[model samples]
Structure formats: structure tokens, C-alpha cells
Target: MSGTIQFKQDLPPKGGYEPIRYKRNLPARGPGGLAVFGGILAICAYGFYKVGQGNLEQRELKRERAWSRIHLIPLLMAESDRDIYRREQAQLAREKELMKDVPGWEAGKSVYNNKRYNPQNFVVM
Candidate 1:
């Protein structure tokens, strides 16, 4: 189809024709947006890795504490028992020393220094 239509009136000549300098209307985008997004993603990934690492460390520490408790309980009980035995032995030695000064002390009744009045023998006023 090569049919062309001719205008009867002459058209005015176009004056001061300014061509478009740029093709796209959008502003120039540098690597700033991509760099910022990449930086945020990297930070998030690092935080996630740290959280996982901390959980593993916490679990390891708990396991070690449990193991220490399991192994030290028997030793601690034995040490407590030894301390009690030593205290009893010391008390027995002191009692023996005190008894050495008196002859036939066990044969006599045990005496207590009673300073207070006997409440059991209270008389009705």
C-alpha cells in the first residue's frame, strides 16, 4: 500500500527545533542501591551465623557443667563426711582430757550448773 494524501494548504515551516538529548526519562542509578542492599543482607547473614554459633557454645558449656557436677558430687560428699569425722574426733579428745582430771567421774551422776529456777517445780502463789 503506497497511497499518499497531499495537503491543499501549505504548512508553516517549523522553527527552533530542539532534539531530545536523552532517550530515557528516568534518573541515573549508580551502584548505591545494590551496594546498600548487599551490605544489609551481609549483616543479617552474619547475625544469623553468630546466633547459631552462640547456641552451640551454650550447649557445650551446659554439657561441661553437667559433667563436672556428675564427677564432683561424690568427692564433695566424701569431703563433708571426713570433716564431720574430724570434728567428732576433736570433741572426743577434749572430753577425754577433761575426764582425766577427775577420778571416778563416770561412776557419779552428771552435774549441770543450773542458775535458773526450776519451772517444773512452780508453786501456786
Candidate 2:
């Protein structure tokens, strides 16, 4: 009977259990120290990775710009040549018309004869 005896409580504290004494700011238990070290290492690695990526991106942009400049040189030369050819054609046409009106040349023809077409005066783009 004594071994089987039990105690029962009819009321409980209003605010639950409390400790009369405890240690303050004890060194954290578990793997907290390892977790903090790992976290710092991960942050540093990420920062370095981002820096490397930025450098690579900058180099790629510079390479692309160089390629664009190289490609544009040929295009500019071709455009200037085309403009010159068109101007030459216009000059030849004017000469042919002048030869046809040699006997009956008008004042308008004389006025236009002094004005010549210049390739450099035109904009390609």
C-alpha cells in the first residue's frame, strides 16, 4: 500500500513554473560555435565569388566592344566607297545631259554646272 500511494494537486500556479536561480550568459551549448564559424566562412566565400563574377562580366563587355569596333571599321569604309560611287554616277549623268544641250544650253544648266555633288557631304546612317 505504501508503495502504491500517490499525491494529487487540485490547484496550479497562475503563471506556470519559475526558477529561483540560474546562470547568466553561460557559453552557448550544442553546435552553436561551429554554426557561427561556418556561417562566416560561407559569407566570405560568397563575397569572393561575386567579385570574381563581376570581373569576368567586365572583361566580357570590353571584349564585345572591341569586336564591335573592329566590325564597324569595314562597314564605315564600304559606306564611304558607296557614297563616292553614287556621286561619280551623278556627275557623269550631268555631263551627258550637258553634251546633249551643247547648242541650246540654258542659264539653268550653267548655274548647276558650278555645283558638284560631294560624297563627304552626305551622312550614311
RMSD, every candidate, angstroms = 14.9, 10.0
Error of 2 at 51 (Å): 2.4
Q: What is the C-alpha lDDT of each candidate?
A: 0.72, 0.73
Q: Which residues of candidate 2, in runs, are more than 4 Å off?
A: 1-22, 25-34, 88-125
- Candidate 2 lDDT over 3-121, as tens digits, reads 57687877758887686666676766777878989999999999999999999999999999999999899999999889878876676576666566577654223334457743343
Pairs of colliding residues, candidate 1:
none
Question: Which number leads on TM-score?
Answer: 1
TM-score of decoy 2: 0.39
**Cα-lDDT of candidate 2:** 0.73
> Which digits, one per residue and each the tens of the lDDT, describe model 1 over residues 50-122?
9999999999999999999999999998998898667655665666666777876652123446655332232
TM-score of each: 0.44, 0.39
